[model samples]
Target: MNDFPWLSVLIALPLVGAVAVALLPRDRETLAKQAAFGISAVVGVLAIVMATGFDSDGARFQFTETHWWIKQFGVHWALGVDGIALTLILLSVVLVPLVILASWSDAERSGGVDGAPPKGSVKTYFALILALEAAMIGVFAATDVFLFYVFFEAMLIPVYFIIGFYGGPQRSYAAVKFLLYSLFGGLLMLVSVIWLFPLSAKPVGEGGLGHGTFLFTELNTMHVDPTTAKWLFLGFFVAFAIKAPMVPVHTWLPDAAQQSPAGALVLIVGVLDKVGTYGMLRFCLELFPGAAKWATPVVLALAVVSVIYGAVLAIGQVDLKRLVAYTSVSHFGFIVLGVFAMTTAGQSGAALYMINHGFATGALFLLVGFMIVRRRSARISDFGGVQKKAPVLAGLFLIAGLAGLSMPGLSPFVSEFMVLAGTFTRHRVPAIIATFGVVLAAIYILWMYQRTMGGPVREGNESILDLTAREKWAVGPIIAVIIAMGVYPQPVLNIINPSVHHTLARLDRPDPAAKIHVAEKVAENGARP
Candidate 1:
């Protein structure tokens, strides 16, 4: 029916669910939670179907659905999936259900010492989460810049409330800081986009004249100058960097991660944060090839700095969630390094890193949240020798922690290695400096493990419960996917490679003369492969 109309459904299903939840009686908390989970589950199933039906060899946007959105502005209601977006969309969808389930007991357990959130809080929470789910999918699926920005900006609202209203001791402070930083970045990006739209709208044939379009397909054809492209790139770049929470812009993440509820933190850090890097891939690089190339060296250097700086910071953290947050800063640095390296392996690794980090980091947050709920503490010093009493929980935490630090045979290891290898090909010195980050990661990860998992059983730890069947069910699949993706990454790489090839091919052709010269040189060298 209408070729699956999948993108619209992906965006709509959860939205419709949110409205239904809003209409339900405030007393029906159980039904509200079930409705939200059911909707997310359906969307997740649809996403899997989309992934399975995806053509590995086609290597083009599939099941695309576009319409005239704003005729006056020349923006179209374009939505579709490529290999890259497909993987990310699937990730967002899969994770939402997990978050709902993971938060289920917590939601029931959180209230005014009565084990229920404030009256109507659960309903509101579930609705906002589902709404956020729809928005995240829209951000990934949107092919129109305007549409993308709309989804991008809209996501911040729900998260702000989730943190400010339902978070920890400093929730209000953390929420405001997070909003301010993101808004600062988003505003700059908005100004940049305003100028970019008209240029993209310029007619394609006229070298000086622009095609006057906001559609990605149309914008892709226009050749932007090196100078104008850089300014425009900064608009998107600043927003992405802050979101990536790169060095000098990462101050907000640790506070937010520590203050927000576990489920909220997972979506904000795991899914929403990826948007910054994804924007770089889909928008800046695609639209401003010259600017991306010009900025590569500087970006790579900053990325290395972020890697080392974030890891060292993580090594010193006492708060468990804050420590996990710092690891994200380090991990994102590698993601950015791989992306800016502009190599096929780097891009694919960056993409895979996004997926793997979500699972690993998200699991870490969930585990820590569970611990906090049990002991009512977030300090690493608050935990010790719990392995004796809660072997299952301890083991899950260990697996997620080791994976976060990029243990060998885990998902992050392959992606992290690929990122470094890819970076080395283009930026050798930065690559080497970044390699030390792996050592730093190991130090911090192992130290955290030893401190939290080792030593004598504290007074309260003797009573700690191992993982419940439900908790195991929640975390088990996450670890399973981590292992599966680590061992057999071909399906993802195959889908990723074509797009990476396409982006690089464009970069290698700044001009026809340069394109021909490079082609000849490669041919004369008999092509390494």
Candidate 2:
């Protein structure tokens, strides 16, 4: 056994930091902010250490920790990391510090004397941000079904407050809408989990829920009827899809994105939203392979609609944040398409897409925030000729915007290509239509760039300064990583492949919709029992 409980350390550090921030004296607001940042930075460092030691070649969970948590329910305090979990956890760590940093000026500005947020509010805000970090890490690290559910639900608390208390004019309404929608989704998932708990209680021969434990490992080994499994699968899918903000359930995301503080927007869209796609992979696909296969065509159709719909909507948006938010819908459609395609390259591409989307989209949101901070506006038409006034800022925006459009040398290009290639191997018609999304992406992305960054310098824009040293530090590395990933994506692919293969192997049921050369049913019926 490993001497240290590293996984626990990851969760505990931030929880403790949050508590510390919460307890700080009102007079020491700056101290409280510093404490939160210091704690988050420390956690980020520890996460990087964990990454260095992570066994990329191995598909099994690492740094695993488990102990009895609730005897009556057979729930355990289990935690671990695979490549999927690792990438998300790293994302959490990376973003928390940036979020804290992003809010520093806003927090102080809002807390000042006239029409500003009170000093006490800053401390509380930072505390909530730290708490959010802990919960996000927990969601990804959890291995037990119960523990995962706990973390999954726990995340909304910080997010709700972040939007409600710190957001724009319609903060309250937006927060409530976000809360009710997510809670509705979460409640459905809770009902599903409650039903799922018993599936593990059966014995193999008697069909007595199979393993009698809530462990994902054990549950993954048990088989459920395809008929009964699809409903359970939908329960999880709806919840995750809402979080993924796919299609109809996606109405809340743009509002939340529009109204939320810059820090919260980064985490919500960049990292938290990924949990939805992750759930589809971890729960829906792995546990209900037959159902997932059965549902692929429908899901793929919705994905195509979202891709086109989001692109079309984005083109019409005046609010920059809302435009970026809609782009995520289109981006997630590609992700979902890759996922349900169920090919090796497709799944890996999906996984890679998550990381790239986070970086690219997160950068876009951050750049927008920076612009809003300087100009006191988020309207696409508010200013132009930014390249002349703030060349570095405009340049970074171009890089991020180009990345969004999936320029060939950017990280998204590699992932998007793989997704298209993999999907074509399975669903040629849908693949062809999905290609239209790329064209749409180019249109919206380039148009947004041209509107915001091109044209003559506006009169008031003359006073605007280029990116600050601190701002450069904040966004530069994110851009660098995007470029690095684009230039050499092999390492990420290598790390992700092992886990993807293992997951696919566990999906033992044949994909009915798949164009298999041999009829699996005929072969099965012909085989000796």
Candidate 3:
């Protein structure tokens, strides 16, 4: 088992499942759906196994498998995971099966806003979803810079079709917008990728005399001029910021989320968007530490703006899906801030926040999807006194909402607190301003809940049914993880800390408190003299 190719298996399982799904008889939609779910479930189990076996104390990459793929271009099919990548891979795997179950009935429903008819085959829908899963796993697992880029761009295809074919009236427009934004960012990254190749061509230990290679380990050893490094950093950072959907570049997310189906939205928001922040930690910061430190002030300002702006916008949203999307913008701000804070606690919190946000927001989106399915409307005004008709659903919604607002006993609260605490150690004013976002979070979540679930029963909502068994199964795990993580974060934090420490070590920035302690020791020594 120790020598097994577990990471390869994790990546291959989903790709194989996708092919199997696509080959199923066109009319046998049920069988295709079942196969997709089974494959994703197995992948989820494998991820759990990987997590359980992971050595929390080790900061080095594990389960690594590297093979030269395009030797001429210095590209390799390299894959590996540290605690950071492993946790994200787990989040991606865990969400896929739940997404399949959550959208099973939605897939069967008549398509279009007017109940015209199904516009796409169920077989293709599930198959595309499975394919997307494969790309996500590949993205997290890829240790070669070029291989990561391949997976990064490859992810857009399945999601594009999912949004365009299976989405709402504005599906085409939203999908196009998403593609355009992503493609623009990708092009900039491609230029950076090409520029980095010459730097890697030199021989190992010969300053810059290694054969050109895209392996992260080799690339990390190659140094570039400071001016050149900053430009490359910007190229990668812009691409990731768009994907992270941070404030200004974030415009596409609400539109895309609004038009996409529930399951697709889960993967889009929960897993795919994470690639941005993950890239910043892995590539931008590690590959260009001088540039990262130089750009910190500007980046921190944008992060603060994202926090306040996204929360304020979320409070004004009338569409439930759109509201969830806006809240993500705000949440992502915290993750970015933590990453840029350049502290172990900050990075660890950012990583943990990514996992917790996935579950918390996933529940909110899934539940909102359920409500939309029941009422055939995404408008907040379409719901009233929903708790009277579906107490279980309302209760679940409250829990998810509370988690989003960082209520003391939920998972997000723990991570959010750590982010702020860490940020204050290095940056006091930005952290203080960012705190206002928390207040706005409460206003938006509670206000939305009160209007939709606590009011007098609307005429049509009285007959809306409670969650079905499948819905319960889908949401139950998310809720359980949320509470468990909030109460006992040590397990995940244990895994996250080593990776965070490793990253901070690479950046070589000292903690302010550590500096202060050193100064105190110097004063004591002087007094003794």
Instruction: Provide the overall lDDT of each model, using Cα atoms, as 2-decimal numbers.
Output: 0.81, 0.84, 0.88
User: In lDDT terms, how accurate is model 2?
Assistant: 0.84
Q: What RMSD does each model have against the real structure?
A: 5.0, 6.3, 5.2
Best by TM-score: 3
State the TM-score for model 1: 0.93
Best by lDDT: 3
Ranked by lDDT from best down, the candidates are 3, 2, 1
Full-model lDDT, candidate 3: 0.88
Tens digit of per-residue lDDT, candidate 2, span 118-180: 233778889989999999999999999878989999999998988877777777788899999
lDDT of 3 by residue, 335-408 (tens): 99999989766787788899999999999999999999998888999899999999999999999999999887
- When 2 and 3 are scored with TM-score, the better candidate is 3
| Residue pairs that clash (backbone atoms under 3 angstroms), model 2 | 110-117, 111-117, 200-212, 202-208, 202-209, 202-210, 203-208
